[model samples]
Target: MLWPNATRVLSKMGLLARLAAHCDSNTHFLVRTSSGKVLMKIALGDFDVPAICVRRADLLAALLSALPSEQILLGHEFRHLEQSGERVRIHFADGTSKEHDAVIGADGIRSRVRQTLFGKSDPIYRGYLIWRGVARYEGNAIEPGANSESWGAGKRFGILAIGEGKFTWYATLNTLADHSDSPDGRKSEIQKEFAGWHAPISNLVDATPDEEILKHLAYDNIPLRRWGVGRVTLLGDAAHPCTPNLGQGGCMALEDALVLAKCIVNHNSIQAGLRRYGSLRYSRTRHIQQRSLLMGHIGQWKNPLVVGGRRVVTNLLPARIFEHNLRRVYSYELPGS
Candidate 1:
C-alpha cells in the first residue's frame, strides 16, 4: 500500500502503466521453497489481518515503460559530495552524472544516505536478535484458520500466513553478552534462548533449514533534529529507523510518500517541498523510532527481575492507551490520502 504513491508518481510521468492492489480473491502468489507444503495464518493486533497481496514482479511489470530506456539504475553506491543551499551533492558508482530536483533517501538501515547526510552513528542494540522463517503449516494450528504470534517473558513469536499453505514465523530471543554477526552463531543463540519454549516455537526452528532461518540483530537508530537540507532529504530508515516491535516502519514510509507528494504539490519548488517534507515527517517518525526502541528494550529484557516487573505493569497499562497510541499512527489520514 505504501508503494502506491511512488508508483503513482512514476505512472504520472509515463514511467509506469498502472498501480493496483489485489483485494479480490483471484490474486495469487507462488513461493518455491522446500519447506514442505506451506500453509500460513497471520493474526495482527489480536485480529485476523486480511491480506492485500501483490507480486513484486507484477508491481515492476506496471513500470515496464522504463524497461526500454534502462534509465533506472540499481546497485549504485552512495558517494557523498559537498552541496550548496539546503541541498547537497551525491555521486553514484557508475560515474554517471545527474542531480535530482530533490534527493530522497529511502534506503534501508545501514543507510548510506543517512550517513552521507549525517555522520555515522551507533545503533541501539536491544539486547536481542530476531530469527524468522516461512514454513508449511500442518493444519489445525489456528482455530479460526488464522495466524498469530505469542509474546513470552524474554521472548516473542510471530506467525504470518502468506496465502496458499505457506506461513512465515519469526522468533525473538535475548542474546548472550557477546553476539556475533555470523548467521550460524545467531541461529545457535536463538535455539539456546528458546530451548524450553512452546512446542510450536521449537517446531518452527526445527523446520527452518540453516539457510532458511534468517538472523537479524535487533537495532534501531535514534531520532535526529535534521532530516533534510534544502534539496536533499531522507525518508524511511534513512531518516528514522524504528524497531519492528511496532510493525509501523513500512506504514510510516507509506505516510511519508503521501506527505512528500502533497508537499511537492503545494510548494513552488522541489527544494521547498523537500524541506517541508522533512520538517513535517521528522518529529512523527522520530517519536515512533524512539518509542519502538524502548518497547523492544522492554520486551526483550535479559533480566528476570525486569521481566517480572514488566509483566506486572502490563495489566495496569490501560487498553485505551494501547488503542489510542496505535490509532495515532495508523488511523492518520494524510492530507493527500
Candidate 2:
C-alpha cells in the first residue's frame, strides 16, 4: 500500500518527525521479469507509514500527559452493549452504563457492530489458501524497493519490503474446490501448490522452517446492507472485508477513519454526519471489496483456458490502464463542500 499521502497529512499536522523514527522508507512491489516466470520481486510500498507510527504514539502520550491520575482505569470489560440513534450505550460488566455521542467500531473484520447492526454473514471461502513468513537480509540481497507480486496460473507470490532488514512474503494457491483442512494440512497444500513454481519462490519457501509459516484461509465477507446504523458507525474490515489480493485492506481502513473523523468534525448533527459517513464510505468500499474478490478469482483461476483469458486481458491492456483504475482508489479525498 502506498502511504505518502498519509505522511503528508501527518507532516501538515506536525507529526512527521514522530512518525519517521519507527517507520521504514523501503518498499517492495509485484512485477513480472523478462523471463516470464513468476517470482518474488520488489518495488515501493512501505515508503512512509510505519515510521509515522512513532509520531502517532507520541501524540497519544502527549495528549494523555495532561490527564489526571484519577481518570485512568484499566481491566474493564463490556458485559452489555446497546445502540440507539446517534449514540451507543455500553453497560459495564459490573452494572454501569455510559452513553457516548457516537461510537466507532474499528475493531476488525468480524466486527461486532457489523454483525449486530448488519447481522453476521458467512465468509465466502475462495477455493484457495496462503502461506506467509518473514526473512532477514543484509546489504540489498534482493535489491531496494517494494510493491512486488509475481502472478502465475493457480498461484502467485510476492515479497513485500517491511524495512529494517526484513521482508514479508505470502503465496496464494488454488486448492481442490472442496478441500477442507486441519492444523498440519496447510504444509501439504503449500508443498503441492509451490512445487511447480520458480526457484525464487521454491527457495524462499524452503529456506523457512515449517513452524515459521503462517496460514490464512482466504475469505471475503458477504456484502453488508449498511455501514452505520445510527449513532454507531463501522470502519475498516468491519465495514468492508476486502480480499488481500489488492492489498488495500489496511489502506481502506485508514481512509475510513480519516473520512469519518473529517465528517464528524465538519457536521453539526452527529447522526446526520455519521449517516453521511455511511453513504460516503459505502459505495467506495463496496466497489473495492467486489473488485478485489474479482481480482482474486482471476489470479486463482485453475484451468488453462481461463489462465489464457487473463493473460490476454492483461496483455491487451496498457499498464497505464491498470494504474489509472487504481489511481482513483489510491487518490481519494473527502468532499470539502
Count residue pairs with overlapping backbones in model 2. Answer: 22
User: What TM-score does model 2 achieve against the real structure?
Assistant: 0.76
Which candidate's lDDT is highest? 2
Estimate the overall C-alpha local distance difference test score of candidate 2.
0.64
Off by over 4 Å in 1: 1-71, 84-89, 143-147, 176-178, 181-192, 312-318
Which tens-of-lDDT digit does each residue in 34-103 have in candidate 1? 1212222112232112223233355456546546656667677776755766445668777754555567
Whole-model lDDT values for every prediction: 0.61, 0.64
lDDT of 2 by residue, 1-337 (tens): 3255445445544555654554455443445422344233322332333322222245456435646767765555444368776567966657777888767776577666566676667667887887787665554435555445667777877766555655667888777545555556555556666676544555566656777788776777866657876688788887788788877776677567667777888888887788888888788888889999998887777687887766666655556556556556645654541
Q: Could you tell me how far off, in angstroms, the CA of residue 132 lies in candidate 1 after the best superposition?
A: 1.2
- Could you tell me every candidate's TM-score relative to the true structure? 0.74, 0.76
